[model samples]
Target chain A: EAGVAQSPRYKIIEKRQSVAFWCNPISGHATLYWYQQILGQGPKLLIQFQNNGVVDDSQLPKDRFSAERLKGVDSTLKIQPAKLEDSAVYLCASSSRTFGYHQETQYFGPGTRLLVL
Target chain B: SQKIEQNSEALNIQEGKTATLTCNYTNYSPAYLQWYRQDPGRGPVFLLLIRENEKEKRKERLKVTFDTTLKQSLFHITASQPADSATYLCALPTGNNRKLIWGLGTSLAVNP
Candidate 1:
Protein backbone atom coordinates (compact mmCIF):
# COMPACT_ATOMS: atom_id res chain seq x y z
CA GLU A 1 0.00 0.00 0.00
CA ALA A 2 1.07 3.54 -0.71
CA GLY A 3 1.87 5.99 2.06
CA VAL A 4 0.60 9.51 2.46
CA ALA A 5 1.81 11.67 -0.44
CA GLN A 6 2.63 15.38 -0.58
CA SER A 7 3.37 17.68 -3.46
CA PRO A 8 6.10 20.28 -4.18
CA ARG A 9 8.49 18.75 -1.68
CA TYR A 10 10.20 22.14 -1.46
CA LYS A 11 8.92 25.66 -1.92
CA ILE A 12 10.53 29.08 -1.78
CA ILE A 13 8.56 32.30 -1.78
CA GLU A 14 8.83 35.88 -0.57
CA LYS A 15 6.97 37.40 2.30
CA ARG A 16 3.49 38.66 1.40
CA GLN A 17 3.26 36.03 -1.34
CA SER A 18 0.89 33.12 -1.22
CA VAL A 19 1.73 29.43 -1.15
CA ALA A 20 -0.15 26.18 -1.12
CA PHE A 21 0.67 22.54 -0.31
CA TRP A 22 -1.25 19.41 -1.15
CA CYS A 23 -1.62 16.07 0.58
CA ASN A 24 -2.96 12.71 -0.60
CA PRO A 25 -3.64 10.48 2.34
CA ILE A 26 -3.40 6.71 2.45
CA SER A 27 -6.37 4.85 1.10
CA GLY A 28 -9.18 4.11 3.59
CA HIS A 29 -7.75 6.52 6.15
CA ALA A 30 -10.43 8.70 7.70
CA THR A 31 -8.36 11.29 9.48
CA LEU A 32 -6.01 13.80 7.83
CA TYR A 33 -3.87 16.41 9.51
CA TRP A 34 -1.55 19.34 8.73
CA TYR A 35 1.35 20.36 10.88
CA GLN A 36 4.17 22.91 10.93
CA GLN A 37 7.72 22.22 12.05
CA ILE A 38 10.33 24.89 12.54
CA LEU A 39 14.06 24.35 12.27
CA GLY A 40 14.60 23.03 15.77
CA GLN A 41 11.07 22.35 16.99
CA GLY A 42 8.58 19.54 16.81
CA PRO A 43 5.71 19.55 14.39
CA LYS A 44 2.74 21.60 15.62
CA LEU A 45 -0.74 20.63 14.68
CA LEU A 46 -2.36 23.27 12.47
CA ILE A 47 -5.53 21.52 11.48
CA GLN A 48 -7.24 18.15 11.40
CA PHE A 49 -9.98 16.73 9.20
CA GLN A 50 -12.30 13.79 9.62
CA ASN A 51 -13.68 12.85 6.26
CA ASN A 52 -14.76 15.99 4.33
CA GLY A 53 -15.38 18.07 7.43
CA VAL A 54 -12.82 19.68 9.67
CA VAL A 55 -12.33 18.13 13.06
CA ASP A 56 -10.19 20.85 14.51
CA ASP A 57 -8.41 23.97 13.30
CA SER A 58 -7.85 25.80 16.55
CA GLN A 59 -4.18 26.38 15.78
CA LEU A 60 -4.60 27.58 12.21
CA PRO A 61 -4.19 31.29 11.65
CA LYS A 62 -7.59 32.27 10.43
CA ASP A 63 -6.34 35.37 8.71
CA ARG A 64 -3.66 33.81 6.53
CA PHE A 65 -4.01 30.05 6.74
CA SER A 66 -6.76 27.90 5.29
CA ALA A 67 -7.18 24.20 4.58
CA GLU A 68 -9.77 21.97 2.99
CA ARG A 69 -10.34 18.25 2.63
CA LEU A 70 -12.98 17.83 0.00
CA LYS A 71 -14.60 14.43 -0.40
CA GLY A 72 -12.42 13.23 2.51
CA VAL A 73 -9.43 11.82 0.62
CA ASP A 74 -7.20 14.79 -0.27
CA SER A 75 -6.26 17.93 1.61
CA THR A 76 -4.73 21.28 0.79
CA LEU A 77 -3.16 23.91 3.03
CA LYS A 78 -2.82 27.49 1.87
CA ILE A 79 -1.07 30.49 3.31
CA GLN A 80 -1.79 33.92 1.95
CA PRO A 81 0.37 36.95 2.59
CA ALA A 82 3.04 34.73 4.02
CA LYS A 83 5.29 36.08 6.69
CA LEU A 84 8.92 35.36 7.45
CA GLU A 85 7.80 33.34 10.43
CA ASP A 86 5.92 31.10 8.07
CA SER A 87 9.13 29.54 6.87
CA ALA A 88 8.91 26.00 8.08
CA VAL A 89 8.25 22.48 6.88
CA TYR A 90 4.57 21.69 6.42
CA LEU A 91 3.78 18.07 7.11
CA CYS A 92 0.70 16.01 6.27
CA ALA A 93 -0.41 12.87 8.03
CA SER A 94 -3.29 10.39 8.06
CA SER A 95 -4.72 7.81 10.46
CA SER A 96 -7.56 5.36 10.84
CA ARG A 97 -9.46 3.95 13.81
CA THR A 98 -9.96 0.26 13.38
CA PHE A 99 -12.10 -2.08 15.48
CA GLY A 100 -10.82 -3.05 18.92
CA TYR A 101 -8.04 -0.45 18.67
CA HIS A 102 -8.76 2.64 20.71
CA GLN A 103 -5.67 4.43 19.45
CA GLU A 104 -4.40 4.84 15.92
CA THR A 105 -0.93 5.33 14.46
CA GLN A 106 -0.51 8.18 12.06
CA TYR A 107 1.43 7.93 8.79
CA PHE A 108 3.20 11.02 7.56
CA GLY A 109 4.20 12.28 4.15
CA PRO A 110 7.59 13.61 3.01
CA GLY A 111 6.41 17.17 3.79
CA THR A 112 6.81 20.44 1.93
CA ARG A 113 9.73 22.59 2.97
CA LEU A 114 8.77 26.27 2.74
CA LEU A 115 11.27 29.07 2.82
CA VAL A 116 9.76 32.51 3.03
CA LEU A 117 12.24 35.30 2.43
CA SER B 1 -1.81 22.84 26.75
CA GLN B 2 0.19 19.64 26.67
CA LYS B 3 3.94 20.00 26.31
CA ILE B 4 6.58 17.39 25.48
CA GLU B 5 10.33 17.37 25.97
CA GLN B 6 13.06 15.12 24.62
CA ASN B 7 16.78 15.51 25.00
CA SER B 8 18.05 17.70 22.21
CA GLU B 9 21.58 16.27 22.38
CA ALA B 10 22.44 13.27 20.27
CA LEU B 11 22.99 10.05 22.20
CA ASN B 12 26.21 8.25 21.25
CA ILE B 13 26.50 4.55 22.04
CA GLN B 14 28.49 1.55 20.90
CA GLU B 15 26.94 -0.50 18.16
CA GLY B 16 26.34 -3.47 20.42
CA LYS B 17 25.04 -1.44 23.35
CA THR B 18 21.52 -0.54 24.23
CA ALA B 19 20.30 2.98 23.44
CA THR B 20 17.69 4.54 25.67
CA LEU B 21 15.90 7.83 25.04
CA THR B 22 13.67 9.75 27.40
CA CYS B 23 10.49 11.71 26.84
CA ASN B 24 8.79 13.81 29.49
CA TYR B 25 5.51 15.63 29.45
CA THR B 26 3.52 17.98 31.66
CA ASN B 27 -0.10 19.03 32.19
CA TYR B 28 -1.60 15.97 30.50
CA SER B 29 -2.52 12.37 30.99
CA PRO B 30 -2.62 10.69 27.63
CA ALA B 31 -4.43 7.49 26.83
CA TYR B 32 -1.51 6.29 24.73
CA LEU B 33 2.01 7.43 23.99
CA GLN B 34 3.68 6.86 20.63
CA TRP B 35 7.27 6.71 19.42
CA TYR B 36 8.47 7.60 15.95
CA ARG B 37 11.80 7.55 14.06
CA GLN B 38 12.83 10.21 11.61
CA ASP B 39 15.89 10.90 9.51
CA PRO B 40 17.07 14.18 8.10
CA GLY B 41 14.92 15.55 5.30
CA ARG B 42 12.28 12.90 5.84
CA GLY B 43 9.02 12.44 7.70
CA PRO B 44 8.69 10.36 10.84
CA VAL B 45 7.81 6.66 10.80
CA PHE B 46 5.81 5.02 13.56
CA LEU B 47 7.80 2.70 15.82
CA LEU B 48 5.61 1.82 18.77
CA LEU B 49 2.76 2.86 21.02
CA ILE B 50 2.11 2.14 24.68
CA ARG B 51 -1.13 2.76 26.50
CA GLU B 52 -1.63 4.29 29.92
CA ASN B 53 -2.68 1.09 31.63
CA GLU B 54 0.11 -0.86 30.00
CA LYS B 55 3.50 -0.82 31.64
CA GLU B 56 5.53 -1.84 28.61
CA LYS B 57 5.33 -2.86 24.98
CA ARG B 58 8.00 -4.51 22.86
CA LYS B 59 8.58 -5.32 19.22
CA GLU B 60 11.70 -6.90 17.80
CA ARG B 61 14.54 -4.97 19.41
CA LEU B 62 12.45 -1.99 20.43
CA LYS B 63 10.81 -1.55 23.80
CA VAL B 64 8.68 1.30 25.17
CA THR B 65 7.61 1.97 28.72
CA PHE B 66 5.02 4.46 29.92
CA ASP B 67 4.70 5.72 33.47
CA THR B 68 1.59 7.85 33.78
CA THR B 69 2.24 8.86 37.36
CA LEU B 70 5.63 10.23 36.30
CA LYS B 71 4.28 11.49 32.98
CA GLN B 72 7.20 10.06 31.07
CA SER B 73 8.11 7.44 28.50
CA LEU B 74 11.36 5.69 27.74
CA PHE B 75 12.26 4.04 24.45
CA HIS B 76 15.01 1.47 24.27
CA ILE B 77 16.69 -0.18 21.30
CA THR B 78 18.75 -3.28 21.99
CA ALA B 79 21.72 -4.62 20.04
CA SER B 80 21.95 -1.24 18.43
CA GLN B 81 23.64 -0.89 15.05
CA PRO B 82 24.87 2.03 12.99
CA ALA B 83 21.69 1.70 10.98
CA ASP B 84 19.74 2.58 14.11
CA SER B 85 20.93 6.17 14.02
CA ALA B 86 18.05 8.60 13.74
CA THR B 87 15.95 11.09 15.67
CA TYR B 88 13.32 9.60 17.95
CA LEU B 89 10.16 11.46 18.85
CA CYS B 90 7.35 10.90 21.32
CA ALA B 91 3.82 12.11 20.86
CA LEU B 92 0.55 12.07 22.78
CA PRO B 93 -2.95 13.17 21.97
CA THR B 94 -4.38 16.11 23.85
CA GLY B 95 -7.52 15.70 25.97
CA ASN B 96 -10.49 14.63 23.89
CA ASN B 97 -8.68 15.62 20.70
CA ARG B 98 -7.41 13.23 18.10
CA LYS B 99 -4.55 15.50 17.11
CA LEU B 100 -1.21 14.62 18.69
CA ILE B 101 1.31 17.02 20.14
CA TRP B 102 4.98 16.14 19.51
CA GLY B 103 8.33 16.48 21.15
CA LEU B 104 11.39 18.08 19.57
CA GLY B 105 12.98 14.61 19.37
CA THR B 106 16.15 12.97 20.66
CA SER B 107 18.88 12.15 18.18
CA LEU B 108 20.45 8.74 18.61
CA ALA B 109 23.75 7.72 17.09
CA VAL B 110 25.00 4.15 17.39
CA ASN B 111 28.72 4.18 16.74
CA PRO B 112 30.57 1.29 15.14
Candidate 2:
Protein backbone atom coordinates (compact mmCIF):
# COMPACT_ATOMS: atom_id res chain seq x y z
CA GLU A 1 0.00 0.00 0.00
CA ALA A 2 1.08 3.55 -0.63
CA GLY A 3 2.05 5.87 2.22
CA VAL A 4 0.68 9.35 2.71
CA ALA A 5 1.51 11.72 -0.18
CA GLN A 6 2.03 15.50 -0.12
CA SER A 7 2.57 18.06 -2.83
CA PRO A 8 5.08 20.89 -3.39
CA ARG A 9 7.68 19.30 -1.10
CA TYR A 10 9.21 22.77 -0.70
CA LYS A 11 7.76 26.26 -0.86
CA ILE A 12 9.15 29.77 -0.53
CA ILE A 13 6.97 32.82 0.01
CA GLU A 14 7.22 36.36 1.26
CA LYS A 15 5.57 37.72 4.34
CA ARG A 16 1.99 38.84 3.65
CA GLN A 17 1.75 36.32 0.81
CA SER A 18 -0.45 33.21 0.91
CA VAL A 19 0.59 29.57 0.67
CA ALA A 20 -1.12 26.21 0.59
CA PHE A 21 -0.06 22.59 1.05
CA TRP A 22 -1.90 19.42 0.03
CA CYS A 23 -1.95 15.93 1.49
CA ASN A 24 -3.25 12.55 0.29
CA PRO A 25 -3.49 9.98 3.05
CA ILE A 26 -3.14 6.27 2.92
CA SER A 27 -6.12 4.35 1.61
CA GLY A 28 -8.73 3.30 4.18
CA HIS A 29 -7.37 5.62 6.81
CA ALA A 30 -10.08 7.65 8.51
CA THR A 31 -8.00 10.19 10.36
CA LEU A 32 -5.83 12.97 8.92
CA TYR A 33 -3.71 15.61 10.61
CA TRP A 34 -1.63 18.70 9.86
CA TYR A 35 1.31 19.80 11.98
CA GLN A 36 3.86 22.60 11.95
CA GLN A 37 7.49 22.03 12.94
CA ILE A 38 9.55 25.11 13.55
CA LEU A 39 13.30 24.81 13.34
CA GLY A 40 14.69 23.00 16.41
CA GLN A 41 11.17 22.32 17.62
CA GLY A 42 8.74 19.46 17.55
CA PRO A 43 5.80 19.29 15.20
CA LYS A 44 2.83 21.09 16.67
CA LEU A 45 -0.67 19.94 15.94
CA LEU A 46 -2.46 22.46 13.76
CA ILE A 47 -5.59 20.47 12.93
CA GLN A 48 -7.07 17.03 12.82
CA PHE A 49 -9.90 15.49 10.79
CA GLN A 50 -11.79 12.28 11.02
CA ASN A 51 -13.80 11.38 7.97
CA ASN A 52 -14.42 14.93 6.76
CA GLY A 53 -15.33 16.13 10.23
CA VAL A 54 -12.88 18.13 12.26
CA VAL A 55 -11.83 16.27 15.35
CA ASP A 56 -9.69 19.09 16.65
CA ASP A 57 -8.23 22.40 15.53
CA SER A 58 -7.68 24.30 18.74
CA GLN A 59 -4.12 25.17 17.81
CA LEU A 60 -4.82 26.49 14.35
CA PRO A 61 -4.49 30.24 14.00
CA LYS A 62 -8.04 31.14 13.05
CA ASP A 63 -6.95 34.54 11.83
CA ARG A 64 -4.52 33.31 9.18
CA PHE A 65 -4.57 29.50 9.07
CA SER A 66 -7.32 27.21 7.81
CA ALA A 67 -7.60 23.60 6.71
CA GLU A 68 -10.18 21.34 5.09
CA ARG A 69 -10.54 17.64 4.49
CA LEU A 70 -12.90 17.41 1.55
CA LYS A 71 -14.82 14.11 1.31
CA GLY A 72 -12.66 12.80 4.18
CA VAL A 73 -9.73 11.59 2.13
CA ASP A 74 -7.47 14.43 1.14
CA SER A 75 -6.63 17.54 3.18
CA THR A 76 -5.31 21.01 2.47
CA LEU A 77 -3.78 23.48 4.92
CA LYS A 78 -3.55 27.11 4.00
CA ILE A 79 -1.88 30.15 5.45
CA GLN A 80 -2.76 33.65 4.38
CA PRO A 81 -0.63 36.69 5.08
CA ALA A 82 2.24 34.49 6.09
CA LYS A 83 4.60 35.69 8.78
CA LEU A 84 8.27 35.08 9.38
CA GLU A 85 7.47 32.53 12.06
CA ASP A 86 5.44 30.62 9.47
CA SER A 87 8.69 29.54 7.88
CA ALA A 88 8.58 25.94 9.10
CA VAL A 89 7.97 22.47 7.78
CA TYR A 90 4.33 21.43 7.49
CA LEU A 91 3.78 17.72 8.00
CA CYS A 92 0.72 15.58 7.20
CA ALA A 93 -0.16 12.22 8.70
CA SER A 94 -2.96 9.64 8.73
CA SER A 95 -3.95 6.61 10.73
CA SER A 96 -6.58 3.90 10.61
CA ARG A 97 -8.34 5.03 13.76
CA THR A 98 -7.78 6.68 17.14
CA PHE A 99 -9.59 4.33 19.48
CA GLY A 100 -8.66 1.26 21.50
CA TYR A 101 -5.40 -0.20 22.83
CA HIS A 102 -4.15 -0.73 19.32
CA GLN A 103 -4.26 2.98 18.54
CA GLU A 104 -2.93 2.71 15.02
CA THR A 105 0.34 4.35 14.21
CA GLN A 106 0.17 7.48 12.09
CA TYR A 107 1.78 7.27 8.68
CA PHE A 108 3.38 10.56 7.68
CA GLY A 109 4.16 12.25 4.39
CA PRO A 110 7.43 13.79 3.28
CA GLY A 111 6.19 17.23 4.43
CA THR A 112 6.33 20.63 2.77
CA ARG A 113 9.20 22.90 3.77
CA LEU A 114 8.08 26.53 3.78
CA LEU A 115 10.47 29.46 3.88
CA VAL A 116 8.81 32.82 4.38
CA LEU A 117 10.91 35.83 3.61
CA SER B 1 -1.59 23.94 29.08
CA GLN B 2 0.29 20.78 28.10
CA LYS B 3 3.96 20.53 27.28
CA ILE B 4 6.30 17.82 26.02
CA GLU B 5 10.06 18.02 26.15
CA GLN B 6 12.95 15.97 24.75
CA ASN B 7 16.62 16.67 25.04
CA SER B 8 17.38 19.02 22.15
CA GLU B 9 21.08 18.14 22.02
CA ALA B 10 22.47 15.39 19.86
CA LEU B 11 23.85 12.18 21.42
CA ASN B 12 26.99 10.56 20.16
CA ILE B 13 27.62 6.87 20.78
CA GLN B 14 29.70 4.02 19.46
CA GLU B 15 28.14 1.87 16.81
CA GLY B 16 27.83 -1.16 19.04
CA LYS B 17 26.67 0.70 22.15
CA THR B 18 23.20 1.42 23.40
CA ALA B 19 21.49 4.77 22.92
CA THR B 20 18.95 6.09 25.39
CA LEU B 21 16.70 9.12 25.03
CA THR B 22 14.37 10.77 27.50
CA CYS B 23 11.00 12.48 27.10
CA ASN B 24 9.26 14.32 29.87
CA TYR B 25 5.81 15.92 30.02
CA THR B 26 3.55 17.77 32.40
CA ASN B 27 -0.19 18.58 32.93
CA TYR B 28 -1.52 15.46 31.27
CA SER B 29 -1.78 11.74 31.73
CA PRO B 30 -1.74 10.16 28.32
CA ALA B 31 -3.26 6.80 27.55
CA TYR B 32 -0.31 5.95 25.35
CA LEU B 33 3.12 7.28 24.45
CA GLN B 34 4.70 6.82 21.05
CA TRP B 35 8.22 7.10 19.63
CA TYR B 36 9.07 8.18 16.12
CA ARG B 37 12.31 8.46 14.13
CA GLN B 38 12.89 11.33 11.72
CA ASP B 39 15.70 12.11 9.35
CA PRO B 40 16.79 15.51 8.14
CA GLY B 41 14.49 16.96 5.49
CA ARG B 42 11.95 14.18 6.09
CA GLY B 43 8.89 13.41 8.18
CA PRO B 44 8.92 11.14 11.22
CA VAL B 45 8.28 7.42 11.05
CA PHE B 46 6.60 5.52 13.84
CA LEU B 47 8.90 3.26 15.85
CA LEU B 48 7.11 2.13 19.01
CA LEU B 49 4.21 2.80 21.35
CA ILE B 50 3.70 2.02 25.03
CA ARG B 51 0.52 2.44 26.99
CA GLU B 52 0.08 3.77 30.49
CA ASN B 53 -1.06 0.41 31.75
CA GLU B 54 1.99 -1.25 30.27
CA LYS B 55 5.42 -0.83 31.74
CA GLU B 56 7.41 -1.57 28.64
CA LYS B 57 7.12 -2.44 24.97
CA ARG B 58 9.76 -3.82 22.69
CA LYS B 59 10.22 -4.40 18.97
CA GLU B 60 13.33 -5.79 17.40
CA ARG B 61 16.12 -3.80 19.05
CA LEU B 62 13.93 -0.92 20.21
CA LYS B 63 12.53 -0.64 23.72
CA VAL B 64 10.18 1.93 25.25
CA THR B 65 9.17 2.42 28.84
CA PHE B 66 6.34 4.55 30.16
CA ASP B 67 6.20 5.83 33.71
CA THR B 68 2.89 7.43 34.56
CA THR B 69 3.87 8.52 38.06
CA LEU B 70 7.03 10.17 36.81
CA LYS B 71 5.39 11.55 33.70
CA GLN B 72 8.23 10.40 31.50
CA SER B 73 9.14 7.92 28.81
CA LEU B 74 12.47 6.38 27.93
CA PHE B 75 13.40 4.99 24.52
CA HIS B 76 16.38 2.72 24.05
CA ILE B 77 17.97 1.34 20.91
CA THR B 78 20.30 -1.59 21.40
CA ALA B 79 23.16 -2.58 19.11
CA SER B 80 23.01 0.81 17.48
CA GLN B 81 24.50 1.35 14.05
CA PRO B 82 25.37 4.42 12.01
CA ALA B 83 22.12 3.78 10.13
CA ASP B 84 20.32 4.53 13.40
CA SER B 85 21.41 8.14 13.32
CA ALA B 86 18.34 10.39 13.29
CA THR B 87 16.08 12.45 15.47
CA TYR B 88 13.80 10.56 17.83
CA LEU B 89 10.48 12.09 18.82
CA CYS B 90 8.03 11.35 21.60
CA ALA B 91 4.27 11.93 21.39
CA LEU B 92 1.36 11.85 23.76
CA PRO B 93 -2.30 12.02 22.80
CA THR B 94 -4.05 15.11 24.00
CA GLY B 95 -6.57 14.68 26.78
CA ASN B 96 -10.08 13.91 25.51
CA ASN B 97 -8.91 15.13 22.12
CA ARG B 98 -7.83 13.04 19.16
CA LYS B 99 -4.60 14.91 18.70
CA LEU B 100 -1.06 13.83 19.59
CA ILE B 101 1.41 16.42 20.81
CA TRP B 102 5.08 15.79 20.04
CA GLY B 103 8.37 16.79 21.62
CA LEU B 104 11.18 18.63 19.82
CA GLY B 105 13.16 15.37 19.67
CA THR B 106 16.72 14.23 20.38
CA SER B 107 19.25 13.65 17.62
CA LEU B 108 21.36 10.51 17.86
CA ALA B 109 24.53 9.78 15.93
CA VAL B 110 25.98 6.31 16.14
CA ASN B 111 29.53 6.52 14.89
CA PRO B 112 31.63 3.66 13.57
Best by lDDT: 1
> What is the fraction of true interface contacts found in candidate 1?
0.77
Report the TM-score measured on chain A for model 1. 0.96
lDDT of residue A13 for candidate 1: 97
TM-score per candidate, in order? 0.96, 0.95
Q: Write the per-residue lDDT of candidate 2 for residues A17-88, one digit (tens) a residue.
A: 999999999999998999999988889889889899998888899999999999999999999989999999
Q: Could you give the CAPRI-style class of model 1?
A: high
- Tens-digit lDDT track for model 1 on A24-68? 999999999999989778889999998988888999999999999
Local distance difference test scores for all models: 0.92, 0.92
Give the alpha carbon lDDT tens digit for every residue of B1-112 in model 1: 6689998898999999999999999997888999999888888899999999999999999999999999999999999999999999999987566568899999999999
Model 2 regions more than 4 Å off: A98-102
Task: Give per-residue lDDT, candidate 1, residue B54.
Answer: 99
Pairs that collide, model 2: none
Clashing pairs in 1: none
